[model samples]
Target chain A: MGIQLDFPAVLERWPSFLGGAALTLELAALATMFGALLGTLAAVGRGTHNALIAGACKVYVETIRNTPLLVQIFLVYFGLASLGLKFSAFTVAVAALTINVGAYTAEIMRAGFEAIPRGQIEAAEGLALSRVQIYWHIILLPAVERVYPALTSQFVLLMLASSVCSQISAEELTAIANYIQSDTYRAFETYIIVAVLYVILSLVMRAGFWGLGLVLFPRRRRLGTPL
Target chain B: MQQNTSSEPIVSLRDVQKSFGPLKVLDGVSFAVDRGEVLAIIGRSGSGKSTALRCIDRFEKVDGGEIMVCGHRVDRPDVDLRALRQDVGIVFQSYNLFPHLTIEQNITLAPCAVKKMATGQAKELARKVLAQVGLEEKLHAYPEQLSGGQQQRAAIARSLAMQPKVMLFDEVTSALDPELTGEVLKVIEQLAADGMTMVMVTHEMGFAKSIADRIVFMHRGKVHESGPASILTSPTTPELRQFVGTGNLKS
Candidate 1:
């Protein structure tokens, strides 16, 4: 039998799809902010001279990057519950996504940090800048500027990967699609609509990051120069 | 020259030694810089001239002996390094200005963050130093926006913003064009005339002959000759004569 087209049937569930799309975005924003903080800290930790701290951060980044995101979500959702720590599906989704993306962010940030020259740090030292001052002014801010594009792209991927959270019935767009398709008995139509929504969501995220890039790195925007 | 209460030597390295892995860069190097005096260190590449300056700022840890900067011993394991660095400023050949910051921000960062000065106060001080470097008009310019000379002057301004007791210049003008070199060298000469203590590692024979109070030549990580600039013009040592005779001394 030829595939029957029923986009209109799935179109009737637009409100549910819209709501699911909004929640996906909310989950992405929350994960991006928190994950960025966690990742930056991990990057600094990995670059430190202390072997123990560096080793631990290295292990965390490698372990997360090596494992599949599906297994990670399951582990985070069921593992936490098994430990008697109950969290809502949305909360678990955000938590799992944050943990997963934080590792990639760490590696990207570490590359940014390494790109800073040894001479710059020595110059900061010669100026009598304290360790904190040197790290913030010479290292951290410029590193962010150098790697902002990479960082933002990773966040967009994180938004797409958030679809995996549907496995736990997180009530995001994919989960909503599963619900609507079963109710309307139109799996192909529901999935196609949901897939289009994801593409729109990713585009929106890309635009948002581009705007943020303009704001955060005004030097680059105004002068057309890299920091 | 007579010494005043506040005019003690700003930098004194006694029996300093440094080694990287198995190779020794500086072996038992000792030198001193009197307050308000301009000292020039001349040496072939990798002869420890730059390494000696780095030791004064504790950028390179000394394996043995003591480095006293503004009366504080930096070689001690328990010293407050950050505080020590606040009194000694250094300029590099690459002009290592923070490329992300504007000239004004680059100059004011250490003062506001490390010295804990108020932001307004730091800005005022930065403006004054930028004016001193003739870069007051370029305060908002980034490093790449400026010419090589302007960037070096801005680097000098950044160090001067700290109001350091001593300044170390590691071939500050080497990276600039000949015409551009004059602008930076003029600023250094003005600082010397104003009685700022400075130790400069440079190949500029004219700068040394005209501005320096003492000239020291290093070879193979050792100070081969130490005397007045007149003596450097016609050095007693064979190594010093060869170094100054060849145009290699003029970066």
Candidate 2:
């Protein structure tokens, strides 16, 4: 007899699957916000004239980018535990995802910063703008607008990778799938549903980022030119 | 005709020396612009005309020299750059208007950020300066939307909103075609007619001859000759004669 599929058994745990998807999104959102901030700072710090600060920023970016995200999650999870620090699995997942995404973001943001023309900074200086004013108005804002697409894609990728948190039993979508599959003995159907949810999550994140980009860089929309 | 010999110069550079490693860009360059006077510096591409103009604004730190502008000593390390820039307005050939900002925003940026003017006040100032540049209609347009000449005019408007004591033009029309160059020069002529103290480094010898109070011919990183507008026609030095001979200066 042919093997029969049993999607109904997996579909019975829709509430658990819904809760898992919500947690996955929450983790991704928290990690993205913190990662963007960390990345922008590191990008600026790396471009600074101070050798020590720039060197430190460079080392952080290179080290995190070269290693696998799985290794980083393990290091943060086990390393913090060994250091006598206690935290929930969710916290550890968010922290590891943030750290992982921050490095990738720094590299992307550095390219954005590098793309700004030297003349723009010189013109700002000529206007007698203070250092802070120049950085915010002339350098950072336009640079971010120019690289908005690349940045949003990175965020989307981070959201998909958050599923790796399932290994630590962080109770995300994949972890929920693992539990439901074992209980119902419908492993294939459980994983297929989980994959669909992840895809939906990524599409939602992309739409959200695109909307944010439109608001943040309205000039690009108006002029059909990169800000 | 603009020789008012009694008043103090608003901008002065004496024995200014600048070197790029081994290449000496400016060697003992000295000049001065009296109040409301228009001094034009003319020379070939690498004659250090641009360097001398940049030094007055402290854009390039002079290796050795005394540079003063509007009573501020520019060559000294302790000189406040922000204050110096406040008193000086400069426009470049490329017209470096911020691409992200609108024309009004470009004009109002300095007055708003540096001078801390209110948004309403800055907008009013932008209106006035944009009008002066004959670009009142382009207040909401982006830099990329404007033609090269319009972009350059907007740059001048942006500088004028600062209300600087002196204006510096570094080949402001070198990037424009002849027809577009005329429109920009017209705005500058109006500025001169209004008695603004100005110094310009230009290849447009014709415009220099017509509007400049005096001209300094730079050659081989030094002042080859300095005299009134008549020098463009007379050309006492051989370098000036050769420079005038080139078709680029068709006065």
Candidate 3:
């Protein structure tokens, strides 16, 4: 017999679901901003002439990217606790997520940086632009523009992956769903709603990023194509 | 007329030598471009003409010998490259314009960043240089939007915005269509007439013969033959004979 479905129980908890989604967005937004900054610095560090700095950035990207996010979350949670330091679950989750996504963003940004034509850098050098000036104008900005799509996708994935923070009692969307499913004994119905909420969030994020791309990269917009 | 009142060469390479791994690109080549004089370097593809031009800008470090540009000893270990570049402008075969910026922005970037010019002044400078290159109307356009000839002109304008004492052109028109080449050459001719001290490695014998006050012919990484523009018409070496007498060597 096909079992009876009870979406009404989940729908009645719309406030809780919405609150959870809001918290998820908060975590994702913070992570995306800080992670982008950290990743860009790491990408630049990787390309620098100093061996020690490049090696350290390499280790960070490799270790973070290779390990699971769940393990990272637990490490940040309990590892801090064991060190006689304590932070809120929300803080721990954001720290974990930022650390995780920064690695991926770094790799994506590095590929973008490498894809820039050598002639571009040479031209800038020939013009007597300082090293930092060259990196900022000729290398970084155009590279970010060329790989905007890749960066957007990685950030969206990071948002979805924020669900794993539930294990650390982050109370994000997934944690709330876990609470509701167990409380109401409506696991199937609760999960379906959460899945739909995730889909909606991802779409909202993509649209927001697409609009940002239009503003930040006017050249690409004017050309109506990737540079 | 004495173009240079000081009678000192503005750009000089003294027995400069450079090698790329197993290949000797610039082998003890020496040349000097006096202030307000146009010097053309002509040679075949493998003759190291481009490398010699590059060394003057320190783009290629010479293995031996010295390079002096605008009073900066480029061969010195502590050579101030930025200072040297500020006084010397270079254009290349490829326009190498920053595609992300407008023509105006591309021309103003170095001046504003390096010279600390205010935005209003930089914009005015951009306008002046763009006018010099006959591209004042295309200032707001991105590089990709312009034709190859227009892009090269814009590149020249970008260099001119620095108001350099000396200009280096490394086959600046070699990549252009025959029809497009004339416009770029015309811009160079104007720069020469304006008394810009220039050292250009060129393949356009006709353009070189007309614009160059002196010509340095390179072969096997050495100055095989060099003299006034008249040398292009009457040569003294067999290489020069076979090059200009029978057929233009493109070398």
Write model 1 residue lDDT over B68-109, tens digit each, in one string. Answer: 888788898887887888888899999998888889899889
**What are the candidates' interface root-mean-square deviations?**
1.1, 0.9, 0.7
Model 1 spans with C-alpha error above 4 angstroms: A1-3, B1-7, B248-251
* Candidate 1 local lDDT, A1-227, one digit each (tens): 98779788889889999999999999999999999999999999998899999999999999999999999999999999999998999999999999999999999999999999999998888877777778877898789889988999999999989989989999788888889999999998888888899999999999998888888777798798666
- Candidate 1 lDDT (Cα, 0 to 1): 0.89
- Order by DockQ, highest first: 1, 3, 2
What would the per-residue lDDT of candidate 2 be over residues A63-181, giving only the tens digit for each residue? 99999898999999999999999999999999999888998889888998898888888888889999889888988878888788899899999989998898888878888889899
**Predicted model with the maximum lDDT:** 3
DockQ of each: 0.80, 0.76, 0.79
Against the true structure, candidate 3 reaches a TM-score of 0.96
- TM-score for chain B in model 1: 0.95
Q: Give the DockQ-based CAPRI class for model 3.
A: medium
lDDT of model 1, residue B60: 84
lDDT for model 3, on a 0 to 1 scale?
A: 0.91
Pairs clashing in candidate 2?
Answer: none
Q: Model 3 clash pairs?
A: B43-B251, B44-B251
